[model samples]
Target: MPNAAPEIRTFLCRSDNIGVLIRDPGTGACAAIDVPEAAPVLATLEAEGWRLTDILVTHRHADHIEGIPEVVERTGARVTAPEKARAAVPGAARYIGEGDRVTVGGLEATVWETPGHCADHITYHFGEARIVFSGDTLFTLGCGRVMEAEPATLWRSLVRFLDLPGETAVYSGHDYVLSNARFALAAEPENAALQARAAEAERLAQEGRFLIPSTIGTEKATNPFLRAGEPALARAVDLPEGTDPAQVFTALRAWKNRF
Candidate 1:
């Protein structure tokens, strides 16, 4: 029989980063997406009373993987990371690449190489669950800072997510909705949807609530990074009306870096 969809939980760690957990209800197997710090992850697991069976690393960045050792020690979870990130992350038991698969008990995650933020970054897609662990590639209304990959390469990665089903729920690596929303408005100040979303994000921030778990359909409609090719965004950003989408994307990234 096919496995049941995994249950997802998101929590904050290290101020701005967001950590994720995916648990297969049928098998009672849980996976930790990245361990910025082990304390909160351990605490969360204890609270949920779920035994962690896997650790899924998205990149080699310190904040993303520093807690792997402790979490692994505490949970005895199998560690899986991008091939390049394996050495940096201690206790990693498996290395995955684009098109590779990682099983969290009966739940299967198809990995996609997304190297814009880091050369070894990857995103996980659980098709049956209609969910994606986007890591730092695609954010709520923005994309990751281009640290290694070329601008064009990152653009391609961002575009790839658009092809997924429109309803796919995107759980990005950080809680950057407030800042990204401000930048998004600068890219499309007249967009009503963008305005409303920004207001909601601001309200959520004021209330100290999480502002993530955005949908692909929502991002496609409001995310400035994803809409670089659209005439409205191009015009708002003062780029030529018909500038190449890739160039617009490059400009947007540069602008966000300084914003």
Candidate 2:
């Protein structure tokens, strides 16, 4: 079978976080993921000779947004972001929310409202690419903090992503693998996959490399938050036997927040 031509270049930046630059082969225009700062993102675009076509902001955190002004000024690119983030995220030329689909370069990206890291946080799912830019909601080995939502909201919100295809590649806003791994071990000491993942993450980080782009399958198998209702989680968090599924999930998240 013939290999597919590459359509994007994902740059790991800002303390091992990411700013993905997706290029349109036909127009040479590029779209970037959460651009925390200007110079690095611009440098990557200039180096590749790709023009900026648009910007996609997963959420409105400063670390994820601080660069939009310069990016808009330099590229004359339109910004597409969550409707609720218009105030928090400047230069949002277009607003998107749940069930909205944004098209670029023969690809269609679907929006998902993922409100835990923040109430207005969103996930962009490029189904054809089998990838999702999870902002701060879902991470490699753990979920984001329950800052914007309560235990209940976060619990149900988390279940939404659990239904994604097993092979979907997750790209989070930051690289917290090392810390998240330790937390997972505390919560699910008996999970062999968690132990194995810690070692692999350590090796990758030691080499100054990324341990991301983890598949949904791997997360479902090892991520403690997603396994919130499992026996190990229930026992570790002191939830009584046969608790309600949602309550079990809440207990697990509460414990992890303190973990």
Candidate 3:
């Protein structure tokens, strides 16, 4: 029999950073995706009555790791961090690289080195569960800013996601759906899917709900970053037809940077 999907909880921390908790019901083993803040994580764990067994560090950003010491001290949860960020994330009990598998009880995740927002960034893919914890690498309607690598490097990481099943649920690090929706519309104004998605994003925001766990299919149709290969997006960026998708992606990222 297939393993049951793990229970997931999503909440906000530190204004915009997302806090995620995933638990295996059979073993009662829980893991926090990243520690943006200790208080909310602790409170959520207590309220849910889930014992945390691991802290999965996505990157070495200050906001992501600042609450680590406190959370680990309190829960004794083992830390799994990216190998490239060993120095910045001293609390890591295990430094993992691409293809490393991490288990929270019976639930398992495969690590993928997806560095673009920062060199140490990694994404956790729970294959059986069809879930991805895409840290600063990918967002709902946007991808992370090209910080430490070239635009093509980030494009490579983003394209890696395209191979996943469309039903795969993507949990990104931050909630920038509204702003990204606006930019997506600007980048592809004639896209009906993007237009509807932007409208839905506004409604979700008004309801104090987050547009998270966006499916790979939704992003493929609506996210401008993912649609760089499309002729409409290429035209929007003032690029001629048949331009390299990477170049179109570069132009889109530059425009988004200024948007």
Best by lDDT: 3
- Model 2: number of backbone collisions: 0
lDDT of 1 by residue, 1-259 (tens): 7677678888899999998889999889899999988998998999999999999999999999988888888878898989977678755788889999888888888999998898999999998788899999999999999999789889999989889899999999899998899999988899898999999998888888877899999999999999988998777668888999888999889989989
What Cα-based lDDT does every candidate model obtain? 0.89, 0.81, 0.93
Candidate 3 local lDDT, 124-151, one digit each (tens): 9999999999988889999999999999
**Model 1 TM-score, all chains together:** 0.97
TM-score of model 3 vs. true structure: 0.99
lDDT of 3 at 54: 94
lDDT for 155 (candidate 3):
96
- lDDT, candidate 3, equals 0.93
Ranking by lDDT: 3, 1, 2
lDDT of 2 by residue, 154-182 (tens): 76777887898999888887888898899
Worst 10 residues of 3 by lDDT: 1-10
Distance from true position, residue 157, model 1, in Å? 0.6
Name the runs in model 2 displaced over 4 angstroms: 1-6
